[model samples]
Target: MFDIYNIGSLILTLSILYLSANKYHRLLKLERLENAGASPEEYNAYDKRLRLECILLIVIMGTATILSQFTNALTVAVFMIILGIILKIIINKCCPIPK
Candidate 1:
C-alpha cells in the first residue's frame, strides 16, 4: 500500500524548507553592510546561520523518513527525496540569486 500523495507531501515539505532557509540566509548575508574585509563577527554570524540550515534540513529529512515508515510508502518516499534533490539542483544551477 504505497501512497504517492504522502510521498509528494514529504518531498514538498522538505523542498520548501530548504529553499526558504537558503533564501533567508542569502538575503541576510546580502543585507550585511561590511565592505572589503571579513571579520570574526561576520564569520561567526555566517557560521551560526549555516548551522541552523543544517539543523532544519536534518529535521525535515528525519520527519520524512518517519512518515515513510508509517505510511509504508517506500515508492512515494523515494520519489519525494529524488524530486527535492532535483529541484534543489535546478535552482542552484539556474538561479544564482544575483550576488
Candidate 2:
C-alpha cells in the first residue's frame, strides 16, 4: 500500500538520483572543456558547484536508500532503476554535447 511517506520518499529519491547524475555529467563536460583549453576562470564556478552538488546528492541518495529499506526494498530498487533511465533522458535534454 502506498502512503504519503512512501510517495514522498520515492519522489525525493528520484530527484536526488537525477541531480547526482546531472552533476556528474556536468563535471565530465568541465573536464572536456579543460582539455580543450577553455580558461579555468571561465569554468571554475561551475566546476565548484557541480562538485558540491555531486557530494550533496551522494549523501542524500545514500540516506534515502537506507531509509527506504524500511518500507519496501524491491519497490525502491525498481523505482531507482526506472528513475535512473529517466535521469538519462533529462541529462540528454539538459546538456546536449556540442557537435
Give the whole-model CA lDDT for all candidates, comma-separated. 0.61, 0.64
Superposed on all Cα atoms, the candidates' RMSDs to the truth, in angstroms, are 8.9, 7.5
Segments of candidate 2 deviating more than 4 angstroms? 1-33, 36-69
| lDDT per residue as tens, model 2, 1-99 | 436676567757777678877867996889897888876565765566565555555554654466475667776677656665665565556544434
Clashing pairs for model 1 are none
Model 2 Cα RMSD, Å?
Answer: 7.5
| lDDT tens digits by residue: candidate 1, 3-95 | 677766776777777777777876666457344455656655655555554555655475666566566677657755775676566545643
Count of residue pairs whose backbone atoms collide, per candidate = 0, 0
Clashing pairs in 2: none
Off by over 4 Å in 1: 1-36, 72-99
Report how far residue 37 has shifted in candidate 1, in Å: 2.3
